[model samples]
Target: MNAPAIDARKWMPYPSAGGAPTTLYCLPHAGAGASTYLPWRKELQPDVDVVPLQPPGREMRMRDEPFENLTPLLNDLLAAMDGVWQEPFALFGHSLGALVAFELARRLSAGEGPRPAHLIVSGRRAPQHPSRLPWIRMADDPMLLEIVRRLGGTPDEILDDEQMRQTVLTLMRADLGVDQTYRYRPDPPLDVPITVLSGSTDSHVTMAELEPWAECGSAGVDIRLVPGGHFFVVTQRETVLRRVRHCLVGSP
Candidate 1:
């Protein structure tokens, strides 16, 4: 039978019919929620149990305050993860979520906590990549909005609706704050296999930035280039599904 669901306050499984032999924990991009990975169920079902980690302050927990720092955030994430850490599991993260997954993996690799069998990171550069700016969260409204718009980070539909526009901006700023404030230090490479995925046309991340991720893990890295921009996880879902399936199949 599927492990009983975590507090539902944190991790939400797609279809809730879990009890699969393996679990895939999906982390979301900035300003996104668990629902963002809902489609993953159709692509990875029967063989893999797909669960999305939901932090406070977004979607169903809209009333909660967003995270401005990473330490406390990671602590909270780990606490909520206690239940599902059982069995063979993998982690898949995109963009901001990728960084979170990497750091979490580092901690898990240290010991005590459960380490994932595989880590699939997409649309993000390696942790050691030098930072270009102090903090995008500190950018002025017009400047920040312009960057998000130019990068297609925020949808136009959300921008069109005043209420949603404000909400999106608010949550995005906090999420970006989490990213901006994060500082990566050198850590021993994880023993788990890593898969680095990126969009062919994603200007924010280049192939050079992705290759370094291979050095962060000892189990070897497989780089896959999907055809799309920054949001390839959405636009190239099938490619991601196939790649993840291939990774899981090859896992021990």
Candidate 2:
């Protein structure tokens, strides 16, 4: 089935200033909108363009229905990003975003396109291992709230507001549904070099769990332990961006 047509540019609200030699396409963690990485442009511009992808049902795409499965979500992304893939680029995704980025990288590697130079994944276990995290797609609303609150990214004000809380939970469930339903199919290892970043104290993903990522990429995988937990992508923003820049541009 053909994925519905979407204005491709809408996915990137903060495009590079057009002077960078390469681009970094970023995918957000579950329940997160692209705005989460908005500050990245300043961190990696001229050298690399930071483009964060905004999935539906979040931020400006709030009214659009979110995809509950990874296949259609990726299909839509592939269709929408047809032109954007022409340039020299890399991918970075955190948590659920990590899985999405990994799958996307595999697709690009197998298909016709300029494959990403690097794949940077954070706070998610390698696909080869079964996810140790709880499957929260079917959890009740209160449970969902607790899970989201425990995850530590969503603002307290949003959770406190009735309408806002509903909106957040709806997006979270749909995104988590994508995670719960995803079944990783074996494929040849990716051609791109991969950098796996894990939080030192991440409650969901341990340092040991990141080891299997080496098998997923033939180009070589570099795994590093940084500070904080699953939400370290935000809490340790500078550290994350620095590592990402190092991976792609060889800076510092």
Candidate 3:
């Protein structure tokens, strides 16, 4: 069966020349679009094809409602990725995207399909570990604003505007619901190697919280520390890109 076509607006493709053995499929954090990785494509070597996966309900798919659960989201993504599983591919996801990548990898490995060569998870704790904070099920307007403030990813201009805030808040609530409802089911470590990235000052996730990612994979796991808070990728782009490139092409 042919794979379903992904919403073009959601996914940003970075094609590469031949002889590049690996393709890196990047998944964005909640409330973000594929453009988040636009800079990485230019910074990385020519051989790696950096294809950023854009989830629905954002950017060009702004008209579509955001997903509120993991199962449906992963199922749709797996379908979209159907025909493009030929080469050695790796999965990279940040925060919420990290959880999706790990779960998707599990689904792919269980099915009669090729698995990603590596899983690069950033800014998220391991699945087996429960979140440190209690779930925020229903946030009032003020609370929502505070949550967004603490996260520090949403733009202040958008959050301040009534119309923009409404649109973003709708998506944010749905994304948070998905995150809150998520219950990690433990399983044996994967054969693929996993790399975890964490920020030294990220209050949401700590070095200890990120270390358990080593148990998620059998081959081995490596952790890299960047110098910033939760949104380290934005502040330390060069350092993050350097680490990613090294992992993708450096001596094994």
Query: Highest lDDT, which number?
Result: 2
In terms of TM-score, the best-performing candidate is 2
Error at 208, model 1, angstroms: 1.6
Candidate 1: misplaced stretches above 4 Å? Answer: 1-8, 13-16, 130-134
lDDT of each: 0.80, 0.86, 0.79
In model 3, what lDDT does residue 75 have? Answer: 74
Q: Model 1's lDDT to the true fold?
A: 0.80
Q: What is the lDDT of candidate 3?
A: 0.79
Q: Rank the candidates by lDDT, best first.
A: 2, 1, 3
Which residue window of length 10 is worst by lDDT in model 3? 9-18
Clashing pairs in 2: none
lDDT by residue for model 3 over 136-225, one digit each (tens)? 566776787678667879989999999999888778777777677789887878888888888889999977788778788888898888
> The CA-based lDDT of model 2 is what?
0.86
Superior candidate under lDDT, 2 versus 3: 2
- Residues 160-221, model 2: lDDT tens digits: 99999999999998988888888878788998999999999988886567888988989999
Task: Flag regions of model 2 displaced more than 4 Å.
Answer: 1-5
